[model samples]
Target: MSYPTSSSPRMWWTCTYAPGAQPFRGLIVPVLEEWSKSNVSDAFPFLAPIDHLLGSRRRISINLAKLFNFFDQEIVQRRLARTGSGSGSEKNNDVLDILLERHAMSKLTRQEIITFLTDMFIAASDTSTVTVQWAMAQLLRHPEKM
Candidate 1:
């Protein structure tokens, strides 16, 4: 099948679906800023309490709470959309949709589902880097298989 040059697995949604307004686009920078700073406890485990006293923990909590709230909002909105959209509506098989589908069968708790998305978001870049390195190592070791 032919594909657009600008599209890949990552951009498939945008390629096939019309663009929608992104109201949260502006709020992302501050979230990045909050996450950019390394946690003190990460470097010095014994000094964990210092983070609480110095307000580092508070900042992290506020940022995470904001992020979690956004996730919660998205979940609710998706539920409404799925319910409101009859069979005529195009089905979206995104991660949240899949998780909600499982949730419908009582397979996952809201917290567990939300954690999956958050972990994916937090580790996506790091995971990609490691994945490429691992693939390269495997390819070099198994050229015959390749």
Candidate 2:
């Protein structure tokens, strides 16, 4: 998938699934931006190790690509469902959810499950890292107060 462009207002929605796009909504953007202010120049040194691991963009663009790929896979799964005889009660879950639920259904192969897990881990890490940093800052600032 290509990088998001300003041409489309809904580009972020296309890149990020609706549930995942919650943070990009107006309310969350301001909060994220406010939280991001703590990440000015000085934060770089502290984030150096992670920067080396995930790179400067934090692989956000890459994850957006993967998310797009996930959409394609969903289409494939839909076709499979249509062709295969399945009841209407068939479960509906996202890729990561399906990967985890596979222990009961065993639909995906081990390797496929692992790759799905990796993708989810990377996606979650991207969001959680920022939250962790903010919490850490609050902790450090309010050591005695906390």
Candidate 3:
């Protein structure tokens, strides 16, 4: 999770967050939560027409756009750093760097890079590993609850 950075004085760096920083209270969590739920269209495919009226589908689209935009900005920032315009370098300092390296050679498309970043972000999120940690913390807080 820690990426070595040439930026002196800072021993290491993180791709998504600072140590002990809870950043999941953001658009990513909401969009993911919405996606995890059962949609009306999932139950009845023909009712897709009513999706517009229901507005749930539109909400997901909007959130997804925002999510993609977030990743796009991250990519641009990392690309700048990788090119020496920002604090990063062309070296494989992080996953983004590796992806961008391949990207520069046309080995990967922009969409593919973004998708990989999205997966990495999601995997780094609390929706998986942190779930167990959180449950243990809660159990310790209220021993009777366990």
Candidate 4:
């Protein structure tokens, strides 16, 4: 149920990028931890209007933007390397590879590719962690039933 162990495979599968322990522990994990914190706006609908006033939304946005930019840069570098290699025949079974292939066919744009990578990281990483935590809590609470 550890975040890094649980999340790393999903991230790798999606982006073909493994953040490794340090970046996962220091960067991705902290963002998820902060995001898990409760917001007052969640309890009071009227407070939603002032959610940004507390700066939590702003901070989360900035952090997420940084994460997205990191992925974007990595994707760009991969594309550059692929072109620079001068052998376009090579292919790997990764999401980035698939996206690039589609891009070559004019099926997707650069911005779309970046957005897909960002969404994949966020959705896969967070959902896997939450699902594992929920399953563990349920099993612990109903050990006899299991």
Specify the highest-TM-score model's number.
4
Summarize candidate 2's per-residue lDDT along 7-112 as a digit string, tens digits.
2213211223454443223322332333234332455676656644644345444544454455446445543553475653344454544453564477776456
Order of candidate numbers by TM-score, starting with the best: 4, 3, 1, 2
Using TM-score as the yardstick, the better of models 1 and 4 is 4
| Pairs that clash in candidate 1 | none
Pairs in clash, predicted candidate 3: none
What are the TM-scores, per candidate, against the unseen true structure?
A: 0.61, 0.32, 0.62, 0.74
In model 2, the runs with Cα more than 4 Å from the true position are 1-63, 86-89, 92-124
Cα error of candidate 2 at position 45, Å? 21
All models: lDDT? 0.60, 0.45, 0.63, 0.68
- What stretches of model 3 exceed 4 Å from their correct place? 1-13, 16-25, 85-92, 123-146
lDDT (tens digit, per residue) of candidate 3 on 100-129: 779989999989987776665555553554
Pairs of residues clashing in candidate 4:
none
Q: Can you list the residue pairs that collide in candidate 2?
A: none
43, model 4: CA deviation in Å? 1.2
**Cα error of candidate 1 at position 122, Å:** 0.6
Separate clash counts for every candidate: 0, 0, 0, 0
Candidate 1 positional error at 86, Å: 4.3
RMSD of each: 7.6, 15.8, 8.1, 3.6
TM-score: which is higher, 3 or 4? 4
Clashes of 4: 0
